[model samples]
Target: MKKIEAFVRHESFDAIRARLADMGLPSMSISEVKGSGRQGGYTESYRGAKTTIFMRPKLKLEMVVNDADVERAVDVILELAHTGEPGDGKIFIIPVEDTVRVRTGERGEIVLASHPDDA
Candidate 1:
């Protein structure tokens, strides 16, 4: 299995989620996160003053998929998340050693197949 972690712009989450749902891979963990990247954070003005937000708000999405589906999931994220600009975010793919379902004590790829509605 592979774990795909993508940090994307806050505004792009809805579209990304919708596309994933359309592909029968809607199961994921999402969180509102803040961090700086290669371009760093930009400056903003308020009350005639300018300030730098070192950490900008972003949406972090994490999904675990079968080894063969890793590229498919990554492609979905890249297609929706790219804005042709900086701070667009990053994606990390990692190996998942195993999985255990708390309720049934299921393990391995079988654990993922338990959800018929998801891929």
Candidate 2:
């Protein structure tokens, strides 16, 4: 199993979610996050003062998929999340040791594939 963590522009969340769902990988966790990449954020002017904002809002999306699905999952994220501009964000794939479904106490990749409807 592998965990796919994507930090993307907030506006891209819905489209990405819909696309991933269509791919049968609907299970995911999302969080509002703020960070900067090579662009390093920007500056704004208020009255006669200028403020440099180093942190920008983004959506952190995380999902676990079977090892075989890792490339496909990453492809969906890359295709939907790219904007050809800075602050478009990044994707990280990490190793998942195991997964357990809380209610049934079932474990491993099987747990990830089980949806509530499967109960």
Task: Give lDDT tens digits, candidate 2, residues 1-119.
Answer: 99999999988889989988887888999999888888765789999799999988889999999998899989888988899987788999999999988888989988877476932
The alpha-carbon lDDT assigned to residue 41 of candidate 2 equals: 50
Shift of residue 65 alpha carbon in model 1, Å: 0.8
Query: RMSD per prediction, one decimal?
Result: 2.1, 1.6
lDDT of each: 0.86, 0.88
TM-score of each: 0.88, 0.93
Question: In model 1, how large is the Cα lDDT of residue 83?
Answer: 90
Model 1, position 14: C-alpha lDDT score: 91
lDDT of 1 by residue, 1-119 (tens): 98999999988899989987787677799999888887755789999899987988889999998887788889989988999998889999989999888988889988765376444
In model 2, which range of ten residues has the least summed lDDT?
110-119
